[model samples]
Target: MFVIVGLGNPGKQYAGTRHNVGFDVIDYLSEKHNIPVNKVKFKGLIGEGFISNKKVLLVKPQTYMNLSGHSVLEIQNFYKLNPEQLIVIYDDIDVDLGKLRIRSKGSAGTHNGMRSIIYEIQSDQFPRVRIGIGKPQKGDLSNHVLSRFGKEDQEEMAITIGNAASAIETVVTEGVNAAMNKFNG
Candidate 1:
């Protein structure tokens, strides 16, 4: 089974914030695939189901962003899955808005959440789908990430979230390389 994790802070307050793009994509996937990601397990909300004939666990870590690795590590150990079976979706402030970057494996650059995951898991060989949120023009980093998108950006974000969901599907159905080739710009 493949474990697809979307990283974000939980709670209604974080909904629609740039940092919650991962959650938004997971929501899109849940709706599209009929997976009810409401069951609490492994420190996350998870739904066990099938995507393109592959058994999958859709996960939304509820431990917030910084502590995401704790939940992810638990799930990884319980399932006895290799790092390759794990796919993480999160926001990237370095890329342009509404864009995506898929990497087979890489060190976490500036994302604290990704850093935590890599540190706890002890591997950088997992697949990841990064939804670009773009850098803030001028503001506190936390404020920029926590803030909601503007009206125009919201429209772009809607499309990006949907695409991110589709990218996850492709990652499951095909492979990371295929998804990257198709989705990455």
Candidate 2:
């Protein structure tokens, strides 16, 4: 089984914010795959189901962004899964808005969530899907990530989230290379 983790802060206040795009993608995947992510496990909201014949655990960590690793590590250890069997999805301010960058393994860069996962898991050799939110034009970075999108950007983000869900499906059904070829344009 593959463990798919989407990083974001929990609670209603964080919903629809740029930092919550990971959660949005998880929500999209849950709805599309008929998986209800209502179970609390591994310090996250999880739904167990199949994606193209492959058993999967869709997770939304409730430990907030910076401490996401705690939830992820629990699931990893419980399942005895290798890093390769894990797929992490989160937002990236460095990439252009509504875009995606898929990697099989890499550094966390500026994302504290990714950093925490890498630190707790003791490796960076895991697949990851990064949704672009773009950098702040001005003001504090935290404010920018916590802010909601404008009307125009919301439409674009909707498409992006759908694409992100599709990308993850491809990753599960095919492989990281195939997903990268299809969605990493």
Candidate 3:
């Protein structure tokens, strides 16, 4: 069994923002696999189904970005799964917009949501797929992340999110190394 977590702030206001791209990927996977992520538990909205013939739990942490680890820890403990059985999806400002980076393990860097997860879980040995949001031209990092994409970026993001969803499926079926080889450019 595996747990796939997407970190994002909950509520309509945060929807479609760069920070919510994780949630976007979760929604894409849910729709693609016909899973309903309507269950409220583990401090998140969860759905269960098979991906690549592996039983998997799809999660969207509802505790907002900074407090995401609290929710993830609960789910991880409840499922009795190891760190390696987990996969996280979130945005990264360090990479260029529309790019994706897959890593078997790494530090959270500037992402508070990922920092929370690593702090609460006490390990960094989990796989993660980071969708790049690019750095802000202006210094207001919060506003940049919380704001929705412009018309042109929105069009490009569709492709990035689709690739992210495919990457998750690859990880489940082919393992992290193969997925990284295929998807990490």
Alpha-carbon lDDT of model 1: 0.93
How would the candidate models be sorted by lDDT, starting from the highest?
Answer: 2, 3, 1
Local error of candidate 1 at residue 150 (angstroms): 0.4
Task: Please provide, for model 1 over 1-185, each residue's C-alpha lDDT reduced to its tens digit, 9 standing for 90 to 100.
Answer: 89999999999999989999988888888888899999999999999888988999999999999989999999989999899999999999998999999999998889999999999999999999999998998989999999999998888899999989888999999999999999999
Off by over 4 Å in 2: none
lDDT of 2 by residue, 112-184 (tens): 9999999999999999999999999999999999999999899999999999999999999999999999999
**lDDT by residue for model 3 (40-114), tens:** 999899999999689999999999999999999998888888999999999999989999999999999999999
Q: Superposing every Cα of model 2 onto the true structure, what RMSD results?
A: 0.6
* Residue 122 alpha-carbon offset, candidate 3, angstroms: 0.3
Stretches of candidate 1 off by over 4 Å are none
lDDT of 2: 0.95
TM-score of model 3 vs. true structure:
0.98
* Model 2 lDDT-worst window of ten: 1-10
Between candidates 1 and 3, the one scoring higher on lDDT is 3
Tell how far residue 125 is off in model 3, in angstroms: 0.2
